[model samples]
Target: MAAAARLAVAGHRVAVYERSRTHGGGVGRLAREGFAFDTGPGLLHLPAVHRDLFVKTGKRPLEQCVEMTQVDPAVRHVFADGTDVALPNASRAGVVAALDAAAGPGAGERWSDLVNRGREVWDATRRPLLEEPLREDGVERLRRDPYPGAARRGLFRRAAPRTLEAVAARELKDPRLVALLESHALAYGLDPRVAPASATVLPYMEQTFGSWYVRGGLRALAYALYERCLERRVEFFFGAEAVGVVEKDGRAAGLRLADGDTAGADLVVAGVSPGRLAALAPGATGPSAVPVPPGRVSVLLALSGARPEGTVHRTVVHGDRLAELDAVFGTGAPGTGSYRPTVTVLRPDDPTTRPDDAHEAVTLTATVAPHGRVDWADDGVAAEFAERMVRAAAAAVPGLPERVLWREVRTPAHTEAETGAEGGGVPAPVLAGAGGAYLRPANTTRMPGLYLVGGFSHPGGGLAHAGMSGALVAGLVVEGADFRGSQ
Candidate 1:
């Protein structure tokens, strides 16, 4: 939608081909019994990215379309040791103080210092890795490992901290602190044990930009973008999945629809998984073909009681230390072990989400093994996992199980059906470290006039990154290959 809106605003004729009946592929909304739930991402970060898009495309800014509010005490963390800390949004001092109060005296200082180092990482990579078209040499520069601190030396030579787990273990000595750092990556379907140290940028970005929510739900942002696209005169084709990219004179000509029809165009912008894109065109592939990561499992709750006042919008209940991480990321499916998954409980304060003041709409999400890893189709298995997640989330919401009027489970199968991802897996955004281990498929593809956008493309996943990808593709389309990027 962002790409379409930008292209239309740039005086280019644009049309969007959507396989589903609606827009916002993964970012969707579900309404049941007067209870509304954001089926995808619950919160928005880096609102400036979308704000910039709106400002560039139309006279009305994003604020006029969707109401956005910063989520204070951005997230509440409940550790295994019963220590709870509410980290304030975009306040370094408040976060340090909260850490000091919850973890220990020096804990805050350590966290502050780590964030300071992360600031260095952010500065070094923000432009080339994010704000511009990725260059080969620029990617190589990121692969050199931009982590600021030196690795602890053993009896032999010094070894650089290669992974997120190594960085946490070496720097944040406190078990709780390590868990906190690891959780940041876990939420993105990244295995902290193998994820590059540059993944530190994840938490740094969130802490700096702050978390935000729309008035009704995060899905509102998607709707706002779709509306912006329509306002720009960008045509949309619902239930029209592009089967192949039609080529004329060796350059991309248009799209071959599933219904034996073609929509001719000068250029084609595909926002799809790398695997799906590969199937669309012969000899056309992306820069990187990384394995698809695990998808999300959300348990939507329509409770009988009212939302308590002064409750933070989001709470994370940490679970069994290393075993849980290994279970979720190590194998395709969570194995039978003492694996208690970390659960993120979301209770948006918006009245639109609930039928009335007396009702509450709650959502519980956990990054689970994707479809192949776990049999999401099995009722017994999904039910057991849902029960486990609800039990773990009880730490954040009191009487969680009993309060439910009704619960709905959305698994990877639903994700596949909606988004057409192979295993309903969600891809992690690119990180700058470990020989381009975190790199995603570049926006510009080998196929002429073909471009990629959204999570599967360069700059990687997340709502902000998706919006940025759209901008990059639009710039490439409008300003030609020489265009650097958005200002």
Candidate 2:
């Protein structure tokens, strides 16, 4: 991690303790029996964050480590009735063009306006929500009830409730575009109703920054980070599952293992669950340790060969309208209404989400049955789910199943047990509501000389963020750098 590596670079002795037997934690992959499968996260979008973290440590030139480009028409949205739309990565002008291409006159103009609105919302919230850490007393003092804080305080309140459905309705004037944008609700686990208006920023970010990928595999990014940690001589104790935290006089000392072994640290960084950490010490509760929300589950297909015709690095939304998409993504579980499947391809050679002319392997993901309570006692359930998803996917690009060499399904159980992902997040958080600053715990715990790092902490989630967070924590502890205030 960047934090550990940074500390070591400053000539401090550091050791990274991991519960899993491997070094790369959630962002990792291994080649086995002739198949190079990415075990965790597989895509990238914002590269600037990683660039900044890497600059702090003299690992390699950012360009030398990873290549990047823009993915035009970043995503393709297909309706159940065969209607198609593309999410272009360009500006308002581009969305207008795509809307014109798929819909018609007036539609383009509406889409342009809608994108402009989304841009406003994105600008207002990106930093406050995604970048800065929230102080508990900060939100308690808010004037509004459980809504956004920074915007109201920063003269950006006009767009405070900037949600996808609301903004799209104001812009496109057609229910279809609204549906297209709202279709993303599954990502937040909210029906357009419960989801916050601010989340429109997720799609807006994609349209603005586009998606990114690392050459060979995104998992390589994690491995590269791990190697960087090693080159700096950071000590590592793999296979040591941290079961408890050692807090003395209100300060963290180290951690107690499930096996009763203890590892001492000056700073403790837990990339694991916040709630889990709370349980480690008396009254050390955090959002992550709380009960799991009504989370959605996801399934990814790692094809040994080429994917079917219509997949892209980002989702190629294939469905009819809003209701149909709901049925697709939500239905696998009862009363869930529907599920939405966003088909994405990881083209390593093309750093952007663009398709590689010679893409050797492919990955696909879809919402499926939640893991914890589901009876997957029958492995056939995964296969059956895969078959249904493939059938639905073929509606867009036929002949996909023939290309399948081998496949694996990571249910919620798989997510928690296999990836140290906490909840249903193989790639994202389980509770979208869990976010809005407090969503992530701080890297520094209430332990003296103990620090925490990884996706679950400040800056939060994704392969790059975890690596950067690790380094950030390392810097704070080893060099006493001020990574706490703001990057």
What's the residue-level lDDT of 33 in candidate 2? 37
lDDT of 2 at 206: 62
Encode model 2's per-residue lDDT on 170-248: one tens digit a residue.
5446666766667555443444543555555556666677666566566667666677777778788888888887776
**What TM-score does model 1 achieve against the real structure?**
0.96
TM-score of each: 0.96, 0.80
Supply candidate 1's per-residue lDDT for 31.
Answer: 98
Give each prediction's root-mean-square deviation over alpha carbons. Answer: 2.2, 5.2
1-487: candidate 1 lDDT, tens digit per residue:
9889999998999999999999999999999999999999999999999999999999999899899999998999999999999999999999999999999899998888778778888998888888898878777887877877653455453565888889899889999999899989999999988888888888899999999999989788888888888888989899999999999898899999999999999989999987788878766763445776888889999998888899999999999866777667755345424468899999999999999999999999999777877778777777788889999999999988889899999998899888999779998888888888788877887888999898988889899999899999989887887989779
The local distance difference test score of each candidate is 0.88, 0.55
Q: What's model 1's lDDT at 392? A: 96
Give candidate 2 misplaced runs (Cα > 4 Å).
30-33, 67-69, 137-173, 188-191, 286-312, 319-360, 426-438, 442-452, 464-484
Best by TM-score: 1
Runs off by more than 4 Å, candidate 1: 150-160, 286-289, 332-338
